[model samples]
Target: MTPPDSQLPLGRRGLLAALGAAGLSASARPAPAAQRRLPLTAQTTEGPYYLDLALDRRDITEGLEGVPLDVRFTVCDTAGRPLPKLRVDLWHCDMQGRYSGFGEQGDDRAQSFEGKTFLRGSQRTDRAGIVSFGTVYPGWYAGRTTHIHFKVINGARAVLTSQFFLPDALSEFLYTQMPLYQRARMRDTLNSVDGIALKAGGTVLGAVREERQRYVATLALVVDPAAVPVIDRPPRPGGLPPGGPFPGSTPLSGARPPRPRALEGSARIRAMVPPRAEG
Candidate 1:
């Protein structure tokens, strides 16, 4: 049987080793800033698809088909210190843009996935403040770019709720070339035009690279461990609101305002490109 997270080592050397085992390097460490506290990761609405299934496993695919993706997250405090023992929950839609356990997804109102679970799982951070999940590259839906939703929980309180985006070029390449991702029509949104992606700025982009048969995406999440969870009104039964999952111009709202002409040329959008491998 696998050991518990508390049994793991947490020193700097041990942390680096653990990170390396998870396909990350010491370079994944957060750089020192002039200020003592780093900016907390931007928060966003959790959308209408989250369900606390209490599943504790690394592979959430459950035999689903698509390009393999290994998702890794390292949780840290505002001071860049690793924070261990926190529970990280992750979920995303499958290759057809359908979420498990939801009868209504996108425009498919008759679809039924009730009692099913896939691409959804939870893991506790090891001493290295890292948790990893084995899932597939997510599919896109109307009004949103390709993204994955995650939450950081301290005990019973959810300290952070946000979504991270995949690089548009990688996503485009897969959707057009991979037979599993082919759809009747191409995705309607890109990272540059996604409202939530624009609101999240550059920090939401995960560092991605190919490893053998699968791809790995890594994200460093700096958070305020003591932050109080913000409660938003529940979505209307059966689906999200008409405009989108979120409905406002605010940081946490999911409003789909007019596309900005300069977003594609902005530094934030440019950061969504996948980084080249270091020699």
Candidate 2:
């Protein structure tokens, strides 16, 4: 059997030639830098809204209306080796900037969406450490820019909790031009001013491209599987921690964020693991 590209002993030029002969371009060859230990993916606050519903499915839109978006994530270790069998949970607000299963979100207090689940789901990585979701472009809310939240889990422990940001220009265009996103006024915060975005740096920005009918956004997550999990402490009363809820906005009501639920057992774990295969 032929060895995998990573196992090949070809030099740079030889690797390029091998890729070309295999009908792949030079870009297909893994860069030499990728062979080194990559920096751990930056960690960010898990804002007030996060629920581990264990809904394992690809399409998370659940009929919510907005510009279609296909979000993809690649998970690998700090040494750049793909890590399969890890659960990735993604959740974002709807076009109206309201998260499912949460009654109160950014100035809306009387609304009740309890027991509702949309724009949220979990999927495990395949052999190549890739997972994809079918959803809509996330809407913006006060105090924060347009973004999506995700968590990487091994067993019951969450190794990383971070958010993905879209380009400000693209977000602005969608808010102003798209009818579905026009319900709200322009987003008050942008990537530049967003405290979390600024702290997380440019690494959180996903590479997005326009497809025929939807937008595709992709991000790479490099984590240290053995690293200690960061504890998510609740923000101060009546507001988020530093760089949290935009200034002058209604302070978030003092409610403890929901704690993540545990996966069932070995059965649940097995369901999250994709069948092993080589790329």
Candidate 3:
């Protein structure tokens, strides 16, 4: 019962002609760089928690100490591939940004938000699929900058939600002390180039840092129906019933396609297309 990330069966007029076939004019402009690799949603969406809390907070799975963060992001595919089982649902804004509620609260239904259900717990995609969360670093609320609001489910029609910032130790400490967060700089933003909607973009944020600080990174998600199928079909430990012959099963001879490891770079995030426009 999970298949909505981008909900692409190619319906709804094929996602509005892939979000309008694009041309580039939101502002920044230089995308056309998805030469080969695929699978990136370039996600983002937690603006100071978007302030919708009336009451709903279990201390958010106990995360609000002060940068105690253990951030880990991994949902790549735009050449920098890495998407295992995919099911990362996160919620943010507590260091002081606010956001600590969802709806119909009763048992707090895990800090309801009606979506991304995770006051602090919804990470999968391991075994190299990548998806780790032990968050903390989230505080600048008012105007906006240091962010975190995810929803990358590869099985439940949320496609590639968004929100993920922190690139350059607040941009070299705000270019020195504080200069409007240096316009959320990351090598001159624009999602890399006037990102209205993948006019021809692909670089699903490789990683975002506070100083290559390693606060945590692995966010390289780009999605829009072009290609999102990293199927290794993992999850076969102890026993086997898919066709008999367990134990690393495979004797009928035909089924060998799971090899792509050894990635240790960290640093790259370019997912900005959400000011509020999703037809």
Choose the strongest candidate by lDDT.
1
Clash number for every model?
1, 0, 41
lDDT of 1 by residue, 29-117 (tens): 56564456766777877877789887999999998878888999989987888899999999999877888877766445567787889
lDDT of 1 at 224: 85
* Residue 68 Cα positional deviation in candidate 1, in Å, after optimal superposition: 0.2
Candidate 1 Cα errors over 4 Å, as ranges: 1-28, 33-36, 233-279
lDDT of each: 0.72, 0.68, 0.40
In candidate 1, residue 199 scores what lDDT?
88
Q: For each candidate, give its TM-score against the true structure.
A: 0.76, 0.73, 0.24
| 61-115: candidate 2 lDDT, tens digit per residue | 8877677789988888876678899999999988767788866554444565778
After superposing candidate 3, which stretches have Cα over 4 Å from the reference? 1-34, 37-39, 42-91, 94-98, 102-146, 152-156, 161-163, 171-221, 224-279
Instruction: Report the Cα lDDT for residue 163, model 1.
Output: 88
